[model samples]
Target: MAFSAFSMTGYASHTFELPCREGLVSATIHVKVLNGRFFEPTFRLPHALAHLEPALVKMLREALVRGTVYCTIHIGTLFALTSRPMVSSVAIAGYIEALNEIKKHLPDSPGDLISAANLVGLPHVVEFVEDPVGHEINERILADFSTVVEMLQAERVREGAVLADDIGTRLDRLETAVEQIAERSREVFAAKRQRILENLQQLVAQAGCTEDANEVQLQHAFAQIEKLDVHEELVRLRTHIASARSILGLDSIEKGKRLDFTTQEMFRETNTIGAKCGDAELGGLVISAKVELEKIREQVQNLV
Candidate 1:
């Protein structure tokens, strides 16, 4: 399958006009996303259209994996046709009360300063009633929302492609360093075995040990020396590197957590090799691999 990735951040918006009894009314929908540990969504809808929030959130959850999603739907018109501005009695009463107090404070204030024209112009005193939308128009808005979601996912995929390429390069460097470590480890193991054999022979000779006794002692000592060999750790490290590459080739959007876990495993094996193998050159290679793994970990966090 082709390699694919998805970022947890993106934004998309769409605006269109729908025919209502009050002539053409415009609806603007926006979807914005940010990285998160799970799918979290918030919606802003007009009071008349609040019923659509549940369905819209479900749609986004299915389309995305991990992010803080924000969606807003605004319905309005340039001019009213069937509806007229309505005055709020409560707002006017509060304004008059506040204005009377102001007059008391300033006894010589101009009467026209607190006139009806001023009250009408104030916010919340007069609000335009919105015409109700039919079920058919709501369905059309839902369809347009799906389109915008697809656009957002497409952008995320494009950004993920860039992340995959950069991470792939770092993995390549790590693999090379691991191979070098493996080569150096073999030489270290052979030289250490030779020194152990020489020391054991001298101890056996000074003790006047028989040939059979000397052989048994050598076998027992060599068994303990094998603990310092890094062959097993190197094998596991290569396996982890392969697993990470396999994860990158997956076409699913669930790569981040899995890749992160594999990176931790790589660290585990690399650290073991560094501890067991005391060769300075092998230590340098292990440190280099660790640096590459850290870079890969940072990149995978941005993936979805």
Candidate 2:
């Protein structure tokens, strides 16, 4: 099966059991990925599983693509039940010597060093004895790591769903902006034609020529102005926008690179419209559309 697209928000927790010299030891692992960057994985293990670091890293590398990942491994018996008291023989001897020196100066009291030895010798210290589970511990850690990876991937898919919805909203806004640009393009052409006509009439009056004499010249001027029309550019821009929106709706993960390329095409078309139209108001509108497209492009970079 294909791997799910990488996402920045995800978390997984799991436990696995492996055979040990004393039966089986359970290893609990937790993995979390946030914001699509690999976070450091922290491993907590009983002394028995410390040797399994290499295997755990290998398993994690296989499962995660992007995001900060955290993995914690816990193993062995939870806590020692019967405590073993540890008394310091050396401490007792030192106390005896001090008591002898103090007795030389004063009558002995119950608080003397000699009396302290009895209490010191009975100092309760618990030593935790760990039975190394050897390779079995490593196996358990690897197994738990596998489960955590799978869980994290599922979380990534859920987060990706939300990202897809946000992208859809931005695309809708961009499409509306593109349509507005197309409409304004038509007005630009009409305005340009009217201005040219007025200029031609003013020139005829200055030259003391009749309207009939300049009729052919006026037709040629109109043809030249028509050649500069941005209607074709506007049509192409809208078509590109539609294609990009369709690409966004795809369930595939390969849409990022394609959407990035489309953003560039959209910018090119908007630039062409702004330059060819030569209307200040249309230019400002094109600029606004380009700004929105850039923002959309920035958000698309995070899409997987």
Candidate 3:
């Protein structure tokens, strides 16, 4: 059978590498899904890269329909660390040229030495730009982000399949419970009719001077017994069961809301059946059926 249901919970993780500067940086993305009515995405990225949240959220909103998604991206250098700082050739050349022109007018000093180490502490001369091409790196990683989304969707589909199977089984059990209630309702109806007639006859014998039972008294008694008629309720209950089964076997992604609504209707019918039942055993069966419906509802809540 096709599984139309989908779960609100899922998990997936992926790691990717993108080139930055003269080396490569490794990054990992983790995705998690939780219950929600809409596509709510929240991300935890590096402070410098937090601006990418809007773009990532937009992509997720387009990919997912319903769920609170938590995606975290962690990036770090793949190579070993070094104490030496990288120097900017452009900045160093400008600083040396400007300093040499001023040195010609200065007093002749033997200690006017400008070493390479001195340039390391100068402004804009030394730099350690880990990811020089930030925009390009971001674009590349975001392109691979589709893989993470696919993994998360696959997990949700697996969960949805399991949920559909469980709900289907519960629906079957509910159908059986309703069937038992229908049978008991019939038995209860016959017993109620016989007992009410017997009581009416007894009343007629006690109050009337005539030997024949009072016709007006029998009519009143029959009117009271009519309240015990639960045929319509039983028929409606079976119809609701069939509808629930059909919804479960569907292949639609929007089936969650519809399935939930159908179960609520079934619950209402079960309550009506209980109220109309005068027999303790029949009332108990109706309650059992209600319990089964409740079980189905709980499982359906997780569906998409």
Candidate 4:
């Protein structure tokens, strides 16, 4: 079977209300799949989500096959009316006093430290705002992942169809070559028998054997040589080829492995035919057919 480059990308978003919190949280997720040797997942997330990276990667790896997948998730928070800002007046007063004392000690230094510009730049000095809820975001990401997986499966099926067609064509070519080899081999057998008989006659005459005895021995020799004919190999090869074609027509995930095994059987039978026939042309054709089968095997490895 032959496979094309399979890929898919999807994005989805959803909003859900959190229990005990009178507000909605929204999540947007993007999923992408590209050809690769293994399942490699990458997560580009905000610092707030650093802890969730491991869990996300594990989930994606469990569901995905061979590909480089990228997942991006965005979470947004909507606070309720009751969520009011809480401020510590004493903390703010103490911060100002500490800054004034530092400026008094170092008169040459910048004394305008409590200005709006400096206050804006100070770490942890801003008015506190509500943190975004993320459970709904996680749920939405899972939903989007499900959709992406379905898309990937559909792509694989479409590519498998193309692969099956290509493999069928190659199988047909191989069967044709096998038939040619078998037909030519039958002719070679007749020529071989004639040559063997002539050699036997010359040997008997040189040894001064009587014509009657020579004739009997030559008949026995010819009978023994007939056992090497490849008629059985040809029959088995054709049977295996037919079975392989039937397998290609079926829509099964195991078709790749099954076809590979059948190819091995076909090659075995072809080798047997080559050895039995001992014809140079048949050997060459068998080798050529085996080469094509190997190429097919390589393509099948990437199949489902």
Candidate 5:
């Protein structure tokens, strides 16, 4: 399998059987990984092997970077008793008394209703303490476990490859959009300056100010012009696009979180550009860039 960044979602199953002194102990492990804000693991295991869950979870956590993992382990034994079931005497007595009282109301109830069969039927009345796996058997199972994990990681890598391609294509489009918006740079500055000059002229005209103060009004307008300029915003937008591409090109496993933060910065810059937009074409380009960034964000959810 190609090793690179991968999605946090995948599935894999493996069955292993070993001949032990007592019997043949077989285990079928099914692992399912789903996207989550953080890493968490839940395991469903047969009681005979439940005590080994902590070790199993630790192995998976070390192998996987992030995900909400659900792992199921079903162990079967042939020709030997792996565990001895125990009956809860207190629970059985309570269940029998409860059942007897209920039977009194139902005259048609059978005489065998409160027998041992009925007592065992009640939940938690019978229990078996999961036995710890033997060291040799545990080692064998864990060794095979690495193989299954490799299968899971392979699937994640394949998924990441596809997602990276899609995200990279969108980044290219964003770069082109940024260039076009920069090319239309003069229109935006001109519009902002015109608005500032008109506002100053209106203020002077309304107050019936003398012509000598018109120079002060012009200076004020220039200051506002400098403040509203979008060169910085455009430059940052382009830089964010470049950064995003650099991250995508890397084969590192940490791409997901980095890309997530970079896209947020890109979105911030796009919003600022949109606010300063005076031309319909620039506004449309900004909207398009947002759409592409949105798609990129969705794809990023799967990356590792």
Candidate 6:
């Protein structure tokens, strides 16, 4: 029930002994995860434990949000260490009878060919006796597996904290750059407005207008200048940055997706600001903000 950022990539392995009524059973578990958009889990277990896959997958889904997860469980040397070896009398007898039939066809065949040692070497002549406490062993395995998954979760959380810290630093830079851009944008807008006024005055003088320009003409000129203003875009960029910061502060499992979307919006606003502002200094600031946003986007992709 822990709520915190978790990275989509992590690895954890554990080797321990599971005590059963039969004896001590050694088990090894490996959990690896890679960045993915969905919960995709792959399990590699002994055929005898194939039925445990669904339960294991349920455990994983409860603990993880999104990743390509790989789970490998080895139960003590292919289930041999947990079970005892037994000689199958029926199989040995069948092998001996078959060999005798072959011997009747070839009277000169060597008797050693059908010896006990040779028959024991044949397939199916020797079998492993399954553990008497099979259900208990499976339960123990599930318990151990849960522990390993918790270990994996801890590793992922640690990595996520690191990523979040890095991203927060980058966000600070982006926010600062955006503030600078906003400040510079004001200056650029003033300069643009002044140039527009100068041009309008020149046009008025060339036309030999004696009286001041009418209100409708002045309003039209101001409106044209406002069209090139990036104030709204800069405001949205700031809002997006704040949203991203807030998401980073939350204890939500799906913050990665939210941050990603916020970054995209920030990019859109940055592009709009760049397109609307023609000042060289403002363009440079927009570019710097874009670089920071790109870095944040990269880190956000690794979060869960």
Clashing pairs in 3: none
- Global fold similarity of model 1 (TM-score): 0.77
Candidate 4 CA-lDDT value: 0.67
Whole-model Cα lDDT per candidate?
0.86, 0.66, 0.78, 0.67, 0.81, 0.84
lDDT of 5 by residue, 1-304 (tens): 1225688899999998865656677778899999987779998876656667888878888778789999987767632435557788888878878878998999897887666676677798998754455777667767877777888999888888888888888888888888887877667778768878889988998988777788877787888787667799988988888888888778677688999999999999999888877678888988988999999999888887
Summarize candidate 4's per-residue lDDT along 255-291 as a digit string, tens digits. 5556768888888988788778677887888887787
> CA shift at 18, candidate 3, in angstroms?
0.8
Overall local distance difference test of candidate 1: 0.86
**TM-score ranking from best candidate downward:** 6, 3, 1, 5, 4, 2
Error of 5 at 175 (Å): 0.6
TM-score of 5: 0.75
Candidate 6 segments whose C-alpha is farther than 4 A from its true place: 1-4, 19-25, 81-114, 122-124, 127-133, 208-220
Model 2 TM-score? 0.58
Error of 5 at 251 (Å): 4.4
- Expressed as tens digits, the lDDT of each residue in 1-304 for candidate 3 is 4556667789989998776545666789999988887778888877656677888888777766778889998877533211235778899889888878877777585555588788678899876544333577668777878789888888888998898888888878888887888888889889989999998877777887353447667668878888888888778878877887787777666567788888888888788878889788997888888888888888888887
Clash pairs, candidate 1, are none
Model 5 segments beyond 4 Å from truth?
1-3, 20-26, 77-81, 84-132, 191-212
Superposition TM-score, candidate 6 onto the true structure:
0.85
lDDT of 2 at 21: 42
Question: Ten residues in a row with the worst lDDT in model 2?
Answer: 76-85
Candidate 1 deviant stretches above 4 angstroms:
20-22, 75-131, 207-220
Candidate 2's C-alpha runs over 4 A off are 1-6, 15-28, 34-64, 67-135, 204-229, 232-236, 249-251, 271-295
Deviating ranges (above 4 Å) for candidate 3: 47-52, 78-136, 209-223
> Which residue pairs clash in candidate 5?
none
Candidate that would win on lDDT? 1
Pitting candidate 2 against candidate 3, the one with the higher lDDT is 3
Collision count of model 6: 0
